[model samples]
Target chain A: MTVAVDIKNRLGDFSLEARFESAGRLTALFGPSGSGKTSLVNLIGGLLRPDQGRIAAEGRVFVDTQAGVFVPKHKRRIGYVFQEPRLFPHLNVRSNLSYGRWFTPKGERHDDMGRVVELLGIGHLLDRRPSHLSGGEKQRVAIGRALLASPRLLLMDEPLAALDDARKAEIMPYIERLRDETKTPIVYVTHSIAEVARLASDVVVMAGGKVAAHGPTAEIMQRLDLLSEEEIGEGGSVVDMTVSAHDESFGMSVLHSAAGEVRVSGLGTPVGASVRVRIRARDVIIATERPRGLSALNILSGKIASISSGNGTLADVLIDCSGQIILARITRQSCHALALEPGKPVFAVVKTVSFDRANTMSGVKPG
Target chain B: MEWLDLSPEEWNAVRLSIKVATWAMVASLPPGLLIALLLARGKFWGKSIVNGIVHLPLILPPVVTGYLLLLTFGRRGPAGAFLAEHFGIVFSFRWTGAALACAIMGFPLMVRAIRLSIEAVDRRLEAAAGTLGANPIWVFLTITLPLTLPGVIAGMILSFAKAMGEFGATITFVSNIPGETQTLPSAIYTFTQVPGGDAGALRLTLVSIVISMAALIASEALSRRLGRRMDLE
Candidate 1:
């Protein structure tokens, strides 16, 4: 296991009990604001001690209550990127970035300042103070500072939460690069499902101070019942589709998966790159038969795997196209009119415009 | 020019006052910082009582504080006797005793300024440092202390100015011995008591104003420079 945590802690009237193990390169702690996700990250980072539990990363035990062992955060070698990019105001960017390097044991150090600066694109900001940098630039410098420490486990607590949409867009690609290129394991915290779908390979869904579900990103995302009410509309199937061809004339790209070809807006990456696409259940429309000449461009024939209805107003239909699963939410009247049921042949149609840049995460170069 | 020029006796008091104030300011810094940090960040059973005791000199009459210092540090006193016997130190009517009294009198102001600054420091930055492998002491040295530079300078100046003008406490704790413990304030008091000493008192009063104004201006410039360096301004 890359990271393992079984902990119980209490703060005032709120208590948290979490247990999960993940070996994924980027594991997301997904939850709403008050769901104790940050507290869990703090526990893993050794910032908060658990009243009872054991936490280990990379086969080294950080805290084991039974054994009476609790390592301090400084010795645990965990890098944390907080929500506010807490940079030392008195130090220049160069000094702040190198601050951790001085404390890391020389023999154990692996992070090269040159490589980290290049990775985060913060070379021009070395001489600037923290107050001089913009929000996006500060966050990038913060990431570089943490990476320079050469931590064994990197913990990010909503690193982009304080940024606007434009800034979030700017910083996300660097985080993806860090996930893909770095050797260290990362545990990211976020309440945004879009962020989880874009970056996380594994997810631990938290609710009401407990682990509601924990599994691979794709599997956990499709379980709409596990999502909060606000997130239910956004929850759906996440599919990794390889870029097989790009229709330059039409300004569209064809993504091939096991299910079928999906055409979205023109992508920036070259052909053969793997991109993750989120098909929101609310955006999907289920049909009894293959519709002819509809405005919706993408349609995949599948069999209805399951139908679940809550409160008798709407229903969620799960369709299996070849071996890939797709989710569609429709009204109960339409569900009953079409006589949808398990093992029934159907087609799941989605409009090309429904898949915007926010729904598509590209930049994973195929290995 | 003849009347403005200070006599040798007046010069001695001015020199002695500067030495005592400088010594008092320098000697109290380390303890002042430690105590400020403790009061700002520590959580203990008698924290309020510690805070109260630290502020006692500020609230209590200067004479009472000076008398208390005399009673504790005097040669016949228990602490005074032990220190005198063991360490060959003396506090009665000595310049060092005046410095000790000034340091005590100025301590509350120093600690208050430093404590407020320490409390204003963003603890999140410290926690971030901890996660990056900086131990607690390293965090204080690199993050906490550097960020609190302006306040530290302010506290030092406050303590220095308080020591420079210190009269009641110094006089009571250590008597006005002209070449030993007669600081500027004591010297001025002496000039004011005599019949033909008006010119000496006026000259020394002008000197005191200049010194106080210089200390304040120096502190303002220093803190502003630090603020600019930290981008806090």
Candidate 2:
């Protein structure tokens, strides 16, 4: 299913004009606070009426101002999960789940309750009241409630913003499962780049109430020129790899990336289990030749593809190793001393321990 | 035992009071809830003016409110004449007129209770329900109304008790006709006017106090039960 939205709305002095389309299973609206990400989602969900625009989801017209046709939020068949759970306090968990079903016309109900409950791991909490559940459990139930509504699309507005880091990690897997298993298109909104990296199949970058860029997750993450200079300084690429082998003698596990095999200091995964690793540009170092006696465990030979000038005294070097792309940020002085240029053969060095294990995920096989 | 021995007149007054208060609550609940929702949730021009109009009876002297009702709902008044001509309905000098005055006097309290509760309800929850495929009316009935039930019950009891004790308005608008327009308060007023009727008046006063206290206790218990069920505790 595809969601196409081009809407312009004015709320006092703040004007929102955005146009973007996504066929990805989960498209993230990523921006900073006051960047109008939530406003854009509200327009798509039919919660806010736009002054002029057209919105279509799965080939169905939700809002077309030129035609003077505006479908109400309920008929749009879009489920919304807010930062707060917003569960009906008067109803028990079971009744809250069934509330959406009550409004679903008999012939349109498609989602299975048992599977949803199992998927969200809320089976035991079915009879409990919302007040009795923890923050994470409430969000999970909220997700399940939205899913049971059999919506055409789901909108999650900073679902993890209110939770602690542990709670966020707790709910991330359930959201990933939802993204992978459900056919419904989801528009997830967040200001956290890490959340977008881990959850979004496509990323729509927003700035100053405008769509700055939109593309597949990996490509957008790698585009230093399109991203804000500040983000490029801190942002990097994510690679999905798998544990190829574990060496007990070396105290490391061999991970196979698209570029080449990478040996990292981790041993939790069995062989052939997929893992996602994020490599920030600032963490990478480039050497003109293979340096001996280096403590860094990763050294891949690659040709420099491009060099980008940043706002400060730094430059971002894009290295193309085989088919995979890696970014390195270095001072202009380093570039001058190393003579780094396009097509120059260099070794991208990454310290084994430098890989952030917190952002790493294992046991997910590549699709 | 002596208090239990009510003469036929006292029995008619008690029954009439029940009938008037019940009818008044039933008749006013729908409008009260509608006004409460509008005032609590709606954004419109002249909203404050509308709010004030709904609350005028509460602030005005009960006798003045009754006088205004009599002028507007009398046989020749615009609304009263139209209803009388179209539906053969009459309010002045009748039991229904007593109910009308009591409802008017009790309306602001009912609306205030319901409005406060409605305002207290989270609008985001209603928006979430809307996104879950519930139309506006369905959301109100299934979510809004049920969530605000404690307030609705409180409003009903408050209005019922107010109607039960309504004196100035009922007497001024519908007059104290013995079995027709005379409610408990009006009957007590009539009994106190005579030299030998002090005992009867004291008895009715005690009954009125008992009924008001009972209504208050019932409302409190009901609200508490609902709060527990909703996990508001």
Candidate 3:
């Protein structure tokens, strides 16, 4: 495991008992605001001392209350990217990026300043002060600073939460490159499902300061109870697909995945680039027989594997198509009218235009 | 020229006042910053008490504070006796005593200014530094101290200005002596009390006004330059 956290803490009246192990290079702490997502990452980063329990990474103990082994944040060798850029305003961009290098023992310092500056594309911003940089530039510099520290694990607590969608997009490719190319593991904290789908290899879902679910991204995304009503209320599955072709005349790109092929609007990386496409459970429609002449452009035939027993009029149906699981939600009346059950063959329909560009995360290879 | 009109004795007073104020301001800077950090970020059992004691000079009468300092730092007092015996340092009726009085009197303003600036420092930045492998000391030195430069400058200026005008505390503690401890304010007070001293008093008053304004302008310019360097304001 790259990171392991089995800690219990109490802040005011809220109690957080989070226990999970992540083997992926990028592990996401997924939850809504105030669900202890930031707190969990902070605990791992040694920013906050847990009242009880332990936090270990790759067998090295960071925080173990039982042994009274609580490493101070500076000595822990864990870099943190906060929600705000948190750059030292008095220092210029180059100095800010190298601020952490001042503390790292020369022997442990491995990341070259030039390499990091080039990676983040901040070489031109070296002399400029943090105040002079835009929000996205500041965040990239912050990440570069953390990388220069040569930390064992990087904890990013919603590093892009302070930026708009455009800025987030601007900085995401760097993080993806960091995840794919770097030796150090990263624990990213985010409340956005799109972020998790795009970057995370493993997911640890948090709710009410507890670990609601923990598994790989592909498995956790389709967990209806974890992301459905009463929880996030935004239930979806993230399909890892690669761009096979682009039809410029029609303004659409062809996506090939294990589940099926899909065509989405908007532009991103060129052909053969991997992307994460999020298909919301509610947006998927189900039919017992193959329907023809429908407005929807995509339809995948699969066998029903599971039907969620919902107290409401709606229920979620899981289908297995070519070793990939697809989720569809239909009303209980329609379920009974069609006599839907496990092992029954069905077709899942989704509109070509319903897919949003924001949901299409194009960076990093699928794990 | 006003500078040429001053008598040698008046010049000595002016020079001594500058010396005392400079010493007071410079000496109090480290402690003022420490106290400010303690008040701004420290969590302790007697935080409020420490805060109260730092601000005591501002609320208490200057004479009382002077008397208190005299009791502790006077030649025969316990602290004074220990210091004199160990380090041969004396504060009774010496120029040093005047600086001490000024520092004590100006401390509250100094601490207040630095504390406000320290409080304004985004603790998130400090935490960010800590995560970057900077120890808390490094965090304070590289992040907190540099960011709080404006406040430190303001505090030093306030202390220096307060020291230049300090009279009651210095008179009560060190007693006004022409060459030894007489500052600008004390010199003006002495000139006003003596007969045929109105001209001297007016000259010194105008001098004091000119010097204080210069100090304020210099301080503002220095702070603005530092602010520009930081690009924070």
Candidate 4:
């Protein structure tokens, strides 16, 4: 599925001007609160008409101000999951799930109720009231309801924002499963960086009601200079790896990446399972020569790809280890001492203890 | 015990009161719902003016409202003339005129109850329904209407009760005609004006109180049931 949106609208004191196109399964709009992420999703869902813009999903025109073509929201076949899980209070869970199906033409109904119920794990909630369900359960049911509509595009605006950390963790996997299993393209809006890192195949970074950057998640996250400028300090590169071996004696897991194998702290997953590990630039240390003695467990040799100036006194060093990219944040003094420049060989030193297992997630397919 | 028995005229008054109240409530329901939806959702020019017009009966004296209705719907008036010529319908000095007066007097209460509920409905839910492929009208019928059932029931009950007690408007518009326009309130008023009529008036008063109390209780019970159904979702 493909979605193209170019819209300009002005609300009181807030002006939204955004344009982005993506064919990714899950394209996340990541930004701070009140940055117009929700507004962008609303525009795509036809909940809000832009003062000037053209929106087309799967080659069907939804809104085109210049052409005076405006399709109402119901005809657009776009499903929206609001932050509050706005379920119809008068209907039971089953009825709410089926409410959307009534509008779908009989012959055009493609989404099976059994599949959606199983996908969201809401089978047990079919007869229960929405008020009786937990917050996580309500969101699951909301998603199921939207899916049953057989929408070509789904817009999820912070579906987990109101949940606690445990609830968010509980729902994230289901969302991930939806991303992998369903062919429907989704535009997910959120302010949480971890959520974007875990779910977004494509990332559109929004700041101050404008698109700061948009690209493949890995490439966008690796641009530390731009991310730091926008106050996204935790932004870093993601590497796809697989569990090559597990050393029970040392309590460590060996992960094989495009660059090379690196040893990290124990991961619960069995060998051969795919994992994505995030290595923050701030946690990386650069060495001029191979370290003779150090507690750091893993080090990879690579050539400096580029050096970009960062906020205040810091600088970002980009390293290319076979085609994989790693970022290191260093001071100008350290750069001068190492005489680092493009084509200069350096060793990227990463502490195994600094590799947070909690931050590490599995199920990323290798390229 | 003696006051419990009603004479023929008192019985006719009681029956006319029931018919007038029922007709009035049924006649005003559709328009009340429409006006309430507009007042709750429409963003149009002169919305406040429309709101004032809907509420005018609440603040205006019943006699003045009755007079306005009489002038507009009288046999010689434009609306009355057109109706008489096209449909052979008549309201002047008839039981229908009495029902019309009661409906006008009770309209404000009905609209207010419905409008409040409509305003309290979550707009986000409507938007969600839209994304789920239900059109706006369908959303209102399936979501908005069911959720606001308690308010609609309340409005209907209030209008029915108001219509049963209508006196000044009914009298001014249709006059007191035995077996025709005279309802329970007007009957009680006439009985009180004559000597040796206290017992008859007391009987009708008791009936009126019983009907009003029953309606209020029924509405309360119905609203509770609706609330539970809505909470299921």
Best by DockQ: 2
Off by over 4 Å in 2: A225-233, A249-251, A352-367, B1-4, B75-86
Better of 2 and 3 by DockQ: 2
- DockQ-best of 3 and 4: 4
**Positional deviation of B35 in candidate 1, in angstroms?**
1.4
Task: Give residue B177's lDDT in candidate 4 (0 to 100).
Answer: 94
Off by over 4 Å in 1: A353-367
How high is each candidate's TM-score? 0.96, 0.94, 0.92, 0.95
Superior by TM-score: candidate 2 or candidate 4 = 4
lDDT per residue as tens, model 1, A1-367: 9999999999999899999999999999999999999999999888899999999999999999999999999999989999998999998999999988998999978989999998888899999999999999999999999999999989999999999998988888888888888898899999998898889999999998999999999899888888889888888888888889999999988889998988887877678887888898888998887899797889998899999998868898999999999988899999999999999999999853233244334455322
How accurate locally is residue B75 in candidate 3, as Cα lDDT from 0 to 100? 91
Error of 2 at A174 (Å): 0.9
A1-367, model 4: which lDDT tens digit per residue?
A: 4888888999889999998888888999988888899989988888889999999998899999999999999999888899999988888899989999999888867889999998888899999888888999999999999998999888999999999988887888788778888878889998877787788889898888999889888898787644535544676777878889999999988999987889987877778877767777877899989997798878988989999874567888999988899888888888888888999999998753233224334353211
Write model 1 residue lDDT over B118-164, tens digit each, in one string: 99998989999999998999999999999888889999999999999
Highest-scoring model, lDDT: 1
- Candidate 3, A1-367: lDDT as tens digits: 7888899999999899999899898999998888999888888887789999989996789988999999988988988888888888888888888888888999999899999987888899999988888999989998999999999888899999999988988888788888878888999999887788778889999999999999998789888777734544456677778789999899988889987888777455677777767777888889988899897888988999999866898888898887788888789998899999999999988753233243334443312
True contacts kept of each: 0.86, 0.88, 0.92, 0.98
A68 in model 3: Cα distance from truth in Å?
1.2
* Candidate 2 global TM-score: 0.94
Least accurate stretch of 10 residues (summed lDDT) in model 4 chain B? B224-233
